[model samples]
Target: MADQSSEEAARLHKFVDPVSYLSAFVSNGVRPDGRSCSTARNVTLNIGSISTANGSAMVKLGQTCVLAAVKMELSNPPLECPSRGYLVCNIDQSSSSLSEALSGPPTSEAQSLSQTLQDLLSRFVDCDDLILVESKLCWTVYVDVVCLCNSGNVWDACVLASTVALINTQVPAVNTDVELPLVSISSRRSLKLGTVPLAATFTIFKDKYCLLDPSREEELICDGTVSVIYFEDGGIAQITHAGKPLSSERLISMCKDGQTHTQTLYKLLNTVCT
Candidate 1:
């Protein structure tokens, strides 16, 4: 009876004031999900999981799961820049992943996320590598990401899955002798890619405590969130903030943490992706 009463009181506190409720846990040096303030959730990576796609990968960051697939299509290069090709990105959120059922087009948030991801990926991809025949036909690389779960930190998960999928992707051999290009489905070669880029997200509570890799519930109660994109070499690609402003010192500290997190992810990729 005593334990039940305690649980009831906890629920009441959470409903009345979420920030204070979360603060109670943080003051105790632990989060509701049993993780330290600085500790991130476990990450799982898999490559070439989808046989039908040219290349595919799946990433799991705790309960949040994302799948990414790459498809190659042939198209004419733009007249202005005939030497370059294209790298397109799209993101889809599954109905089961959200609180409500999705019946129509993607939500505005999903579209915004897709556009942001595309812009970030464009910085890494070299369209020159996509050219099959210069000034003629080129490969349009389509990268599709599907959110199977939205437990939290989805941006990082999407980036991880997309990067691995691109690494696993292969281009089919093309026969240019004929009027129409003949693609050999069985004959394929992998694209050239350099260092992979990844993202790390942090949630700030009450403008004081910074939590790494926040869960869905934590995100709801967060005062602000920061996302940092970086490469394996500790070079930052981008930093974005939402909700509240942060001090320069705090931003720099988060960047350092993001760099460290990227290095850890790179090592894990090497071990699991082969």
Candidate 2:
């Protein structure tokens, strides 16, 4: 049985070579999906889908689907970082969707992706904005992301979902001093956020062609990927790259493209929210 499995794996590896070649050809200004190198797949954002969450959103980027839920709870600050309110992001890939060959807890890939998002969000959200009191209890927002489908570009999809969820979330006001505390929510209140940050991912193939928002097949063949996080105020919050390093010229071009794409995504989110 082991021998047969090994043979099958070898055959699969050999079969992938031709597909990689075809992907390389498409990366150079053409694609099997009939999209240009800089084009993004269709994006859809649905808000308030989860009843249990204070704020929730479902985002679809092409075939990739992510559901993010935000829950607000009163809690003391972390021992290490007590000055600011807590913001926790947990990302989990659905085992049902992932291949059996990739079994485990979140691999390094998922870990890095989560951290990148955390960094980008930290830059845009002022933790002080969530503070209802000084040293007492404050609202700690918890964001949970579940990737239902992995068609590619999961990072970008997750970012979009988080941003929309945050915008739609409403925190309940608490009267801590009263004997009969009132936990009433003012729906008209909006969270004080600084700016919205968007993320765009680009894949490099054949060390020459740059593909944006790659599909799962393309991701399997690519040499490297770069995910750039752009803030609305024309600032870059984070840049995460995996695999071989890309040239500075390519990096600059990708950043420029990401900036333009980010604006479009922001507008789309605004339209959906309104």
The lDDT, on a scale of 0 to 1, for candidate 1 is: 0.89
lDDT of each: 0.89, 0.81
63-127 per-residue lDDT for model 2 (tens digits): 99999998888777665656678888888887754563266778677787688677777766678
lDDT, candidate 1, residue 41?
Answer: 91
Per-candidate TM vs. native?
0.94, 0.86
Worst 10 residues of 1 by lDDT: 94-103
Candidate 1 lDDT over 1-274, as tens digits, reads: 9999999999999899888888999998899888988778999999999999999999999999999999999999988889999989999987888886385899887898899999988877788888878889999999999999999988899999999998888899999889999999989988777668899999998898888889988998888999998888888877889978899998888887777777889999888778
Q: How many residue pairs clash in each candidate?
A: 0, 0
Candidate 2: C-alpha lDDT: 0.81
Pairs of residues at least 3 apart in sequence or in different chains that clash in candidate 2: none
Residue 21, model 2, lDDT:
50
